[model samples]
Target: MDDRRELPRKLAHEHLARGDATGWFEALYAEADGKEQVVPWADMQINPHFAAWLAAHPRPEAAKRALVIGCGLGDDAEALAAVGFQVVAFDVSPTAVAWCRDRFPASTVQYAVADLLKLPEDWIGRFELVLEIYTVQVLPVELRRQAFERMAQAVAADGTLLVIARGRDATDEPCNMPWPLLHDELKFIETCGLREVSFEDFLDQECPPVRRFRAEYRRPATITSAKS
Candidate 1:
């Protein structure tokens, strides 16, 4: 088997053994940088689903704030910026953040190192749109719930949250790295006070069709009472 095939598993075991659930992300990106190969999840393009969604529902110029969680390699971030968003794209790995900045020297997206679990206080409810793709599924199963909550917390009231990830049915046994999210798990976003605008599950056109879900949720507008 190619070392690249085993790289994620090996990194997961090493980091999880040391009680570092999220450290494998940084380690894997560093290794990929050294090897000069495409990272497993790096398609070198923005997610097609995200692009399609943007086309159908163009955001207003005044509602330009966007947040990209686990922004790898800056492709998605750049895509958001190209569409007129004031984007803040962040990854837990400093190496990944630095790589994105260096890769897109002329980019308008602000790339930074930010842990999803311990986000900055000021960032809470700060973005008009939050894009979360494949980030939660990569976390240890134990951390998925909290990660989901934090991601939801970033969306400003009346904003939108879009999530795309590998999906599995309730009966499938839990697997390792890139753990597929269950349907119920994805539905948990409603628990964070956002209303589901849409949810779709489909198979991608890969050799072996990959099961995935694309979900959009929106924060309801807050009603303020008139002061006499």
Candidate 2:
């Protein structure tokens, strides 16, 4: 791994070890502002899977609402806004939200500081689309289930949840920083009253290809359908 990349990872591990479950996010963003090279996950581009999904599955209405979890640097949030969704993108770090707004002064994306585990009441069941990319994997395993529940709760009755995360086999031991999601863990998202619409496992195009899971789950229009 690149030494520069390891800086934020080390900071994350240090903070998480000290029982600060979310402080490392702020520290990482603050450090990245000073030295952009430290943000290993900052691709500076919208996720291609999201883009392709949006292209192939356009919403009937142009004014849908979208929620982007852990909206780092606002790239994906901005992309959603560009496609005409009223977007609310949030991160746990105040610094990250401020940086995102500053980066896009006239942007339509409403960037805010919000915790996934303790989401705002008004946000529950309000979004037509919820996008989560690599956020839960960075969290401690104990917090992942709550994070998933919050993500699911934000979706409207007919809304869709898009999740993209690093994938690992079920038997793989938990690793540092981003603890890759096991296949069963990914499937667990369905337990939150959503139906799995599509699921795919593929190798990312990067050298020494990274395994990834790209999935879509939808909250059915009715309780009966959702249960089925």
Candidate 3:
């Protein structure tokens, strides 16, 4: 396996052995220091799908609340802020969060260390847009439902939740590193009371293209939710 891929799984297996599913994130980020490739997902740029979405839509006239799950190096959050979204980007890894702060000394995006399973109560149903790019697929499969539920819950009424992930058929063989998400697993998002807006299963612009799912879901407007 490529070192880019092997290192994370190696660290993950070690942490998982000690009954820690999330700790390896800090271990990997800490070990990486400032080398982006050391942490494979740290491309140090806004995700292309995210960039494309922003291009298609008009920029926010005001500061719309946006959240980035497992923000890694914070490029996505910065991009959101650049487009006038009030962005809050978080990672379970404290080292990664700290690195984001250091990297953007003057950034307005709030970079916090947070766990998806137990998100900040103040964040629930608060964001007008939630970006969960490549976060869910990295976690152990068993944790999928809870993470999806929480991501869904983060969207305010009539707000959008955009999930970008590697996609695999239910029959695909189990893989490593960034494991691909099964289509059926995503249904849980709808169960969390968000309606599917649109879903695209396509290949990205990688050298060797990879299958990806970019799904959008929206919370319906109701009597409440969304505090100023």
Question: Candidate 1 overall Cα lDDT vs. reference?
Answer: 0.86
- At residue 204, what lDDT does model 1 achieve? 86
**lDDT of every predicted structure (CA atoms):** 0.86, 0.87, 0.91
**lDDT (C-alpha) at residue 42 in model 2:** 73
Sliding window of 10 residues with minimal summed lDDT for model 3: 1-10
For model 1, the stretches where C-alpha displacement exceeds 4 angstroms are: 1-3, 34-38
Residue 155 alpha-carbon offset, candidate 3, angstroms? 0.7
Summarize candidate 1's per-residue lDDT along 1-228 as a digit string, tens digits: 235547878888999999998898899888787343636777778888788888888656674789999998888889889888999999998888888888889999999899999988888999999999999988877888898899889999899999999999878877767788887987788999899999989998777888989999999977899899
| Per-model TM values vs. the true structure | 0.94, 0.93, 0.95
lDDT value for model 3:
0.91
Model 3 per-residue lDDT tens digits across residues 143-181: 999999999989999899999999999888888868899
Q: Tens-digit lDDT track for model 2 on 136-214?
A: 9888888888999999999999999999999999777767667888878777789999999998899987888888999
Residue-level error in angstroms, candidate 2, position 227: 23
Checking candidate 2 for backbone clashes, the offending pairs are none
